[model samples]
Target chain A: MKKSSLILASAGALLLMAGVYLAFFVAPDAVVRIDDRELVRYSQKIFYFHVPVAETSFVFLLLGGLFGAMYLGTRKRSYEQMSYAAVEVGFIFVLLVMITGVLWTRADWGVWWEWEPRLTTFLVLTLMYSGYFVLRSSVQEESAKARFGAIFSIIAAVNVPLTFVAGRLDSLKPVHPTVFTLQGASMEGPMLAAFLVSMFGMLLFATSLYIMRLDLLRAREDIEYLKEELEVG
Target chain B: MAAGKQVFAIVKKDVLAELRTKEMVIAMLLFVILAMVVFSQAFGVILNDLDRVGGGLLWVAFLFMSMLGLNRSFVHEKDEGCLEGLLMSPIDRPLIFFGKMLGNLLFLSIVELFAVPIFFVLFRLELGASMAGIFLATIFLSNVGIASVGTLLSTISINTKTRDLMLPILFLPVIIPLLIAAVSATGGIMSGEELTEVYRSMRFIAVYDIIFLLVAYALYDYVISE
Candidate 1:
């Protein structure tokens, strides 16, 4: 890694460690209602990291779309790399969010999964990006692959809101709790501080990971180009 | 010829070709009926739950059947290098996209028309005379939405190595919203619910159709590139 990237990555690592410390050690536990007659004592700690990671995944995917459009317009290989990198980082963050989300859901709701709007929307988004990777792998020619990937990212970006609406509409039909009990409820001072710290830390971690992925892709492309050149020479 | 005329000319040519072969619709109908049979057999014991399951089955059948047509829609062009010819033609790319999309929509609608009635008969369910109009409207809106997106994706995926398999993987997720609305509206009508209750999903379908149609129309140019 380059000097700047190494510094950034280590800084991100340090911040995330600190943030986790804050989340577990400093944050207070709170009681939440799961059903009409039941209450569960839950640690509100996960929300700080979970919400940021989830929201950051959206940002990374959006960047994927934006860079994808740029690649489509310019036909530049670098933009394609950026788009792919953004999606790779976003996909990891999304997986983390899902793991954390499911754990938190199980803790609070006593069930592992619910067809809630946000959860369903994220699931579809993950599927779409997985499809994006599948598309990327299927095409042989480099330029065609880039163009197809770019087109897919753009399409997936558009599908996100539609998926949200559809998921929300489905949620309205079933009589389950549409809202996660802890979400949007106010937090205490230490809880708010920890949430903010973790949120910033997660975003930094996501961006640093994106940079690392981009650098790795670039190096791979360079090595491949050199190999081909050697064969031709 | 003008672009609009060229679009129709391609549509007409495709329709005439389909009329001659009768293969696309036949395959689509056969696939759909097969799916219906499988679903009925699988859900055989639970006759009471057909009302809930039938609408979802209907949309899945439509979606898979449409895939058959969409896959076939590009074969002739790909086989004889007619896609190259079209690209070399004076007409614009979006026009060609519109032509093929319209052709796919027509064939898909025909398959739906055939499959829906057979599905009702095989499953022993009814859309009711009053609910039939709303169900058809939902079908229409969702078909256009799927057709538009499917056309663009099929064109892109056909060039890939796994031509046939890639289309569905890329297609199903994109059309989730349309499927959501269509299945909900169909389910509502089947359950003897008021039209007012289902109108929201219908509106969602209509909006999905319009927005995706526009997106596909614009993006089709990039998708068909050599």
Candidate 2:
């Protein structure tokens, strides 16, 4: 397992390096409108790393929900740990999404923040997931913490779609430019390659981080269990 | 006969206790009235346009009032450790959820009933084109959503170190969709817009209420037992 993880880690790094090169020098800059004026933009470059990482983060969020449901079903501590790790990794990626989204919004909309659907929903998602961590930390008992956290995760998962739907229906903001639909131009070969590489790199990164965190949590739990055993003896 | 008596006993105990102390009602009412006063001060300069902000203020008041009431509802159980006894009872955990949610809904409705009149008098704004029945329906449905979700959350928060503070932290984000729906519905009524325009929001609230109520009911056993 260690050998496999090391391989995955190195592959993730290598793919990321390749993606960076492709994004910077290989892919063409797609034209975009800024403030009703057409601008040839280079930060369209951010999309390669940005969209893939954002997509990966959402995948982790759903994985967290899946593990949460599993934990509830099996009453296993390991599943809870995996769910917690996924949420942590998911949060880091969510931060990246927000940062990259801000840059893109500024480049395209000429505004730092817009209460648009995607951005607003992402903000709410970030908040909802952060509350998950808060809920876990606020409780002291291990069983209670696990139970509450699992329930909350499932509830948050259920709400995520409702939130998206609500935002879509309620948002008065106009839909902005999207990469897939810009002038009916599809992603060229190099751009598609870079996007896929970045996505694979992100998936690998998330996997390693999840395993590392899970190991650390298990170690901590083991030590706590030993202490309890010692005191009982 | 025995089951009916026990359920009534639980309900009567809660109601009698509430009547005697009036802590939950008074605290929630005072908090909401204070909020309204603050709103009046904040919007004093816009008195001419008070109608525009009136709907928002009404919902804001309800939101904060619900928060306060939710926090208070569990205080007695936590203070006296009576919640442990309740959990040990043969009655199902979901019943506790329903009992508490119904109690909260009753208190919240009472507060809203008083608040609407006070709000109208303070703002001196007519109901305009709002159908009174629609407005009442909005209040009824909104309270169910709040109480259902709030009951479970308050239970979760009671076990936390922050207890009261954690309730809103854990609750507000989950409840935002409901709030948006409510505000839009109220806004539709206030703006003299067609009810059809607010149907989407109302439907969303109904869906939210059903989903959360079911989830909370299913999960309440795990929550109280552990």
Candidate 3:
């Protein structure tokens, strides 16, 4: 486990460095025309990292849900730990997505924020899961905390797909340009390599964070258990 | 021994308790009325065109009012150790969810009964002749959606220190689809549009109600067991 974690950590660092170099230097600037105004933009470079992070966060969220269902079925403490870890990692990645999104919006949309569907839905998901942490902390009893947190996590997880569907199908909803089809030069060799590296790096970073947090939580629990044993002795 | 009898007993206990105290119902109704008055005063200039904004105001009032009722209902159970007793009973956990949801729906509907008229009076808008029944259906279904999910979340939140504040924070995001559906349906009805136009939103709310209720019902056991 230690060796694998160390490998992931090194790979993540290497990928992040590659991503920064490629994003700033290798990727060409994108030109967009809005309201007949041709805007030559460089900040479109954020897309390489932004899109992959956002995609990864959703994957993490879905994994969290899957772990939540497992916890409910097996009633095992490990599944709950994994689920909590996934959500914590998901939160960090989602926050990074939001920050990059804001930067992109300010450059492209002439505003720091807009209520576009993707942005709005992601905002809602961020709040909903953050509330999950608050829910966990509010309960003092370990058993009750685990039970309620698991249940809430599962419920909130089900809402994610529904939210995505609702955002897509609502007729009154505003349109966001589909990233894949948008006008941009297709990824060249170096840029593609850099993007993949960064993506792998983010996954490693997320895994490391999850493992660290879980270890800390388990250690805390161990301390509490030993204290109780000492008191009884 | 009978399932029906157990369900009846649970419902009766909740109803009788609320009847004697009138705390949850009265507080919810008063809060809705006061909120409406405050809204009206705040938007006094827009009163002349109240119909334009009435649908939004009605939903805002309902959302906050439901929050008030949900928090109070669970707090009452927690206050007297009644929820612990309920958990200790041999009855199915889902039944408790149903009983509590029914009680909340009943109280919310009664509050709406008063709120609708007060809203019409203050806002000077009348439901169109053709849309009255659809409006009622929207209200009924919206309340069911709110009560079903609200009951389960309130149970979870009641254990937290920030019980009152926590309910809305935890609830509003989960129920955003319901809010959007209710507001759109109400808007459609107010504007004398065809029910078919609002069918999508109604179906959305119905689907949400079923999915969430079933999820909440299945999970209630774990929540109360701990």
Candidate 4:
């Protein structure tokens, strides 16, 4: 591995460890006093990790869109591969967000799921990208697969925000807390710190995974090209 | 003007072809009516919430019916190598997209005109003239969104190994927001709710139609190209 990636991997590992510790121990538990008993929402701790993973997923999906557009403009396989890698890593994070999110929902709301804006949009998003992979596979030709995948990614990207808006429109009564906002006014103090730590840590982890996957995919593509050349020659 | 002519020519060709065979439209009509029959059986006969679920049922049928229409839209073109010929022509690519999308919109509207009445009769629902107008408006806007996206996706699906099977897999998730808005708008119209109640959904459908049309138009060149 390159020294930069090695450093990145180590840094990601350290920050992730620190973030998890801070999430559990350093960050104050949300406590409720009821009937002479102290009730704590341990499930709320999942929020720190879940929000970070979800944000990282969005960032990577956007990166996939960017790379997809680049692939179309240049017709370069490299950009397509990078976009695919980003989507794959992003999808992993999306699954994590859902798992952790469902856990939190079950704990907090006493249901396995809620049709809140974010949750519904996430479901749409997961399906959209899953369809992306499905579309990719159903195409037989390599170039056609890349082209269709790129176009689909761009469409999916544009739809993401629209889905968010529509989801928000229907969710007049949101079960999820509006912790982070565009204006950035809601959360404060240690909660904010913990969130930031987890956010950056998860982002770093996601980036490292994307980079690693891209490298592996590129190497595999190179091997396949060489084999094809040998067969033709 | 040249692009307009090309678009019209393509639309005319598709319409004439459909007029000759009438396969796509008939299939869509039957599929939708059958779906309505099934839903009425489930909701009207068994559960007895046909009124409550009418909007959902309508949009669901519309979505699947449009999927069927779109999946078959490019079949004759692909089978006859007509799509390849179209691509080789000097016509601009997005114009091709608009042509196909417009053709789809026309056919979906025809199916809707037939299906809506049958739908009401089957489900035993009543619609005033104004309510019918609102309902048709929702269908039109939703159709625009569906046809625009569906046309783009069907082009890609035509090139895929699974052909028509890939269309719904790619189309459904992408159409969720439009579906939500359309279903809500239809629900509002069906319940005789205030225009304000359906206003947001109507706006959403319109906006979704415009955005998806533009995005699909912009991306059509890449998809139709080799």
Regions of candidate 4 where Cα sits further than 4 Å from its true position: A32-38, B45-47
Pick the lDDT winner: 4
Give the top-scoring candidate (DockQ).
4
- Residue pairs in clash, model 3: none
Residue-by-residue lDDT tens digits, candidate 3, B1-226: 6777777778788889889998888888888889888987898888667655677888998999998988888888899999889988887776888878888888899889887887777666787665777888889998988998898899899888887878987998888777777877788778766668688778888888889889987887777775
- lDDT winner between candidates 1 and 2: 1
Q: Which of the predicted structures, 1 or 4, would earn the higher TM-score when compared with the native?
A: 4
First chain of candidate 4, TM-score:
0.92
Per-candidate chain B TM: 0.95, 0.93, 0.94, 0.96
Pairs in clash, predicted candidate 1 = none
The per-model lDDT (C-alpha) reads 0.83, 0.82, 0.81, 0.86
Q: Write the per-residue lDDT of candidate 4 for residues B61-177, one digit (tens) a residue.
A: 989999888978888789989999989888887799999999999999999999999988877789899778888888888889999999999999889999998888889989998
Could you tell me which 10 consecutive residues in candidate 4 chain A have the lowest summed lDDT? Answer: A166-175
Q: How good is the docking of model 1, by CAPRI class?
A: medium
What is model 3's C-alpha RMSD? 3.0
* Clashing residue pairs for model 4: none
Docking class of 3: medium
DockQ of each: 0.75, 0.67, 0.57, 0.76
lDDT of 4 at A31: 80
lDDT of 2 by residue, A35-95 (tens): 9998788767878888888888888888888888888888989999988888888889999
